[model samples]
Target: MKREMIEDALIQPTILLVEPDDKVRPSLMDNLHSWGYTLIVALSETDAMQRVQGKGEPFDLLLMNQVGHSVAELVAIGRDICQHAGLPPSIPVVVMAECYGDDLEGQDVQMGDYEYVAYLEDGQQLKELLYLLCPVP
Candidate 1:
């Protein structure tokens, strides 16, 4: 098999991405896929809760690209989803923000900011952080 194909075949980490931006969501989704991550996209709060309530596999991470909510709000929403899903406690909740760096890397931050500008700034950075948290290997 081709190297790229073989790489794509690997099981990547699955994350629930809450992005309310109508214009930006698609781009973000495409980037996440290209970065070797599987994403469950939720365009709104209700939509996100519905997905969490569904009979589907629990996501490894909860990432929010806030348009209105604060970091605390993101964490609260993540907590709600975990409880509503009736799954394990403490699903890592990360709010993608303007300020971030290598310190947040490789850590499953629950209810905190992720250096989204840095990680999302580079696909390799995002991949590294997610892989460290989920560890497909």
Candidate 2:
């Protein structure tokens, strides 16, 4: 019998997480990492933008925590990054926030041109949303 190569194993999806809070960022990273995700943690929008600009390849998904920034700012940044990267305007972008219900009002934004769910209440919800956006191999 032939042995299977390590490369034959399924590869996990990569996610770019833009979260500013020190307390939340680590925990989120730990959880996602344990879940077999390749996480790129960016502390701020600027940092996140730099990473996206430098990386030659596009991430499977983008997870952003709208903590310090305004909704308009976040949306604009997200849109610009996707457009600059040549990714679809409807690329998967998961926005997590403490005041999502209120902050997200009138955003009229959808992930991949479909209704997007806000994973604000629970961390697991974010993971689930990511799975929906980009399935694990």
Candidate 3:
């Protein structure tokens, strides 16, 4: 009998996107899917928590909307997911908002004290930030 080697599985980076806007979700879903990312969508914080703490495969990153929760609150949720869901502590968490006064195109505004938590104001910025966070090998 001959033994065959099993090749290492290729794991595409998975993202949990918590956006409630009906219009925005489809566009983001299309974009991220085209970019080779595995995306999971949740419309509310409750849904996000369920998915995060669920027993399924871990998400590589979290992208949330600030419509329902503040940046601090989202960060806390990410911490909780790490604590309760066995996700890595270093998993990137980014928050998206429709617009901001100082938001420039293709740039993520850094929230103070939680610089790793990006504040994205537009689709371009979100795209740039996502690619930066999970660069393709």
Task: Return the TM-score for each candidate structure.
Answer: 0.69, 0.75, 0.76
CA-lDDT, candidates in order: 0.68, 0.68, 0.69
Can you tell me which runs of candidate 1 are displaced by over 4 Å? Answer: 1-10, 98-124
Rank order (by lDDT, best first): 3, 2, 1
Q: On a 0 to 100 scale, what is the lDDT of residue 87 in model 2?
A: 69
Model 2, residue 39: distance off in Å is 1.2
Model 2 residue runs over 4 Å out of place are 1-9, 54-57, 100-119
Pick the TM-score winner: 3
Model 2, 50-91: lDDT tens digits are 777754457777777777776556766776766666666657
What local lDDT does model 1 show for residue 126? Answer: 60
Q: Which candidate has the top score in lDDT? A: 3
Model 3 lowest lDDT segment of ten: 1-10
lDDT of 2: 0.68
Report the candidate with higher TM-score, 1 versus 2: 2
